[model samples]
Target: MTRARTSLLPYLLLAPSLLFLAALFLVPLLQTIGLSLTENGELSPANYQRMVGDLNFVPSLRNTFVLVLVVVPAQVVFALAMATMLQKLRLGRDIVLWIWTIPLGVSDLAAGLVWLAILQDRGYLNSALMALGVIDGPTPWLTYETPVALFFSVVAAEVWRATAIVLVILVAGLQLIPREYAEAAEVFGARPWTIFRRITLPLLRPSLQTALILRTVLAFEVFAVVYAIGGRNFPVLVGEAFVWQTDNQNTGVAAAYAMLVVVISLASTVFYLRALRTPPEQQP
Candidate 1:
């Protein structure tokens, strides 16, 4: 009996977490899937059909993909550079890092509102531009007619708000990398860029994979920031879901849109897991 209990120790410890996952994620997920696929007490694809048929569907999907493709890569590059710079710091590093990550404490809606204040007509950005003689007066940038500018505005706010998450993850991974390897490479006349390319990147694959998956997932789920900045001018998948649920009063269609988001998130995660997979030889 003692040996059996000892053998079950790890699983017993995991019991609460498993229960929490079931209660919080799995149950709701099953309900959503059911809700999305069923109609009048029968399983059907009518909700999905309705979702796809909505006029906003194509624009929402395109905008969501565009945002994810643009934002995730930008965030990764910026965070990686920031993390590398932070790693090179020998003094006041933690203080600087803490300052850098201050944005992480800001909620998504609050961050969006913060930027909206800057980007809106007659907002700080326009006032600064006018003062600098860059513009004659307030210009409407966050309008449907200015799609390109609105898109970029949302991108800027998202990067400012969320890049800190990737930075922290990469910093943790960089610190775990044994410094002796880098030093040895330096002694062998390896250049800084080469060391980063051949040494740092290869070792940082796990962290890169993690950051990519997380940021990509969030990018797909983007709603609040875009809503605050561009509103209906920039249609995204999650925003469409919200519109369906609240504005359209269509719960099934909203559930369908949500399932689509979950699918896209899962697909991106699988891509990263496979593409940036760590070799057994590289495993720590």
Candidate 2:
């Protein structure tokens, strides 16, 4: 009875979470996958065919991958740098930390819109540039199809909005690392970089893995910012999916795109976990 009770307790504790995931996530996912294969109550491959042949679809996918490739690493790097600085800082630490983390409470849509105002041709950026004589007049930012500029804008917005989340996670991980480890490493005459490489980063693996997985999964769902900044001129995968579903009312094709996005996100998460797996460090 005692053994069975112990096992039952864990299952009982897990039941709510399992049920929540089943109801909110799994069921909707299964329905979406099914919908992608059927339209008007008739099964068909027509949606997939359209998606494959859609001229803009391929480019949109390429653009989305490019955005992820640019944004995720950039956010991670910025987050790591900020985390290190916050860890090392002394004066005004609380104020600086709160400022760094303010974006955590802001929505991606809001962040995108806020940046949209700043980066738009007639917006603050252009106004400043014109004031400084850097440009004689307003220059269009969202209009040009220049890949570098478009990518930079997207990456900046994404990093600015999301880096705080990574910082919080990494900071938490950093805190859990004992100060004694750093002190001991210092006593051994380890350089700052050497201490980080040999001690801090190794202990930070789990937190890094969690942050990477979360950020990567969220990257696939990026829409509002891309839409606000690039519009259809420089569509990303999520924006393309949104256009198909909302604007075009092509539910089947949109479902297909959504399903693909889910698959890619899950696969990327799995890849990150495997790539970042490290042996557990001895804990004090």
Candidate 3:
């Protein structure tokens, strides 16, 4: 009886968490999937078909992919550098980290507004450029005609706002790495880059995988930043989803878009897992 009770304890302990996940995530996900497959109470692919046939669909999908490709890599590199610097800092490290991570506390909409203020015509960037004699007039940085500028502005805002998330994860990973490995490598005269390449990076694979997966998923769902900065000019997948639900009042098409975003996110997570797979011997 004691053994049986002990065996049941684990499942009992897991019940609340499992139930919460089912209620909050699994239920909504299943409902969304069902909605994506139905139209007006009948099972149909009309929602998906309409979504695919929409004029904004391809552009939004392409823009989403491009944004993820551009921003994720840049954030990863920048975050890694920042994490490395933080790890090396011996004095005022906490203060520096606190300062660097301030953006993490700012909401995405707020971050977008902040960047919009800087990138808009007559904004700080233009004022600075004009003061520096770099431009004779406002450059129309966020204009519809300047798609490249709009694209880059969204990318810059995303990178600045989210890199700290990756940085925090990497910094935690760096902290877990034993200093002895680096010190031993140094004793054998391994260069800093070589030590990082052969030692630090390989051990940091799990963290990198987690960070990449999370960031890539969020990149797919990015809406507020793009909406705030580019508006209708910069069509993206999540923005299209919002438009279908709000502007068109089509819940079916909105669900389809949501499913597509989920599919892309799952695919990216799978790619990261395969690409960053740690060897059996490397498993902790």
For candidate 3, lDDT tens digit of each residue in 1-284? Answer: 99999999999999999999999999999999999999888999999999999999999999999999999999999999999998889999999999999999999999999999999997899999999999999899887899998999999999999999999999999999999999999999999999999999999999999999999999999999999998989999999999999999999999999999999999999999999998999897
**Model 2 — which ten-residue stretch has the worst lDDT?**
275-284
Winner by TM-score between candidate 2 and candidate 1: 1
Best by TM-score: 1
| lDDT tens per residue, model 2, 1-284 | 99999989989999999999999999999999998999789999888888878878888889888888888888888888888998888899889989999988888888888888988888899999999999999887776556677668888899898888888899899999889999998998999999999999989998999999998889888998888787887877778788899988998999988888998998998899789986755434
Q: Please count the clashing residue pairs in each candidate, in the order shown.
A: 0, 0, 0
TM-score of each: 0.98, 0.95, 0.97
State, as a TM-score between 0 and 1, how close model 3 is to the true structure: 0.97
Best by lDDT: 3
Q: What is the C-alpha RMSD of each candidate to the true structure, in Å?
A: 0.9, 1.6, 1.2
Kindly give the stretch of ten consecutive residues in candidate 1 with the minimal lDDT sum: 66-75
**Pairs in clash, predicted candidate 1:** none
